[model samples]
Target: MREPSMPVRENAAEQLEERQSDRAYSKPVVVLDLLWDLAFVAAATAVLLSSRDEDPSMPLRLWIVGYALQCLLHMVCVCVEYRRRHNQVQGEVMEDGSGSGSGSGRSSSSSS
Candidate 1:
């Protein structure tokens, strides 16, 4: 039987460096992701609430308030997450977004 040749091993530092490029999310992409998440929440709430046959008006009103609150909360969270990333990524000596910083660059405290 013939022996198989060994594959070349990649350097750990090189792999890490290579992975660092373009790691931050784009502004539009992040907004789109949050929008899709919000959309999912809205769709699920609508489907579940609508499935019940009685008193759509009151529940609909309640759902609107709840949905608005949920969307607000989601936006806050996404913004916080992005801000944290911005701070950490900015602190990093490696690459940065340069011309493209997202969501105000408000410099909030980071916890991890």
Candidate 2:
């Protein structure tokens, strides 16, 4: 069987880079998503609590506060992780492009 041609490989690489670039999220948008998620979770919890017989409102209120803090922490951690990985991938792509450009512009593969 013959290996795929260079034009095909370059097309595939371009598609991959486009996909990678598209996957990045704006920080504010991500935070807004997290807030929406928290709203749904909180609404569910409120519904469940309303159906119960317990009367102590203070503890539940405190727990909700703590849960919100935990969610904020989770959002921070998630954003940090995403940014780190995105930067790493972009850096790798830059290094790869530069490295290849510095040599004979031709790729090392025999398909050229």
Q: Per-prediction RMSD in angstroms?
A: 9.8, 8.0
Q: What is the C-alpha lDDT profile of model 2 across 4-62, one tens digit per residue?
A: 68778886786676555446455566667778767856875775577567667566656
**lDDT to native, each model:** 0.58, 0.62
Name the best candidate (by TM-score): 2
Per-residue error (Å), model 1, residue 8: 8.6
After TM-score superposition, what is the CA distance of residue 75 in candidate 2 from its true location, in Å? Answer: 0.5
TM-scores for every candidate against the unseen true structure:
0.43, 0.44
TM-score of candidate 2 against the unseen true structure: 0.44
Question: Candidate 2, which ten residues in sequence have the lowest lDDT sum?
Answer: 102-111
Tens-digit lDDT track for model 1 on 1-112?
2233222233344445434533445467678978887786777677667776775555665666677677778778877877776666566523335635422232222212
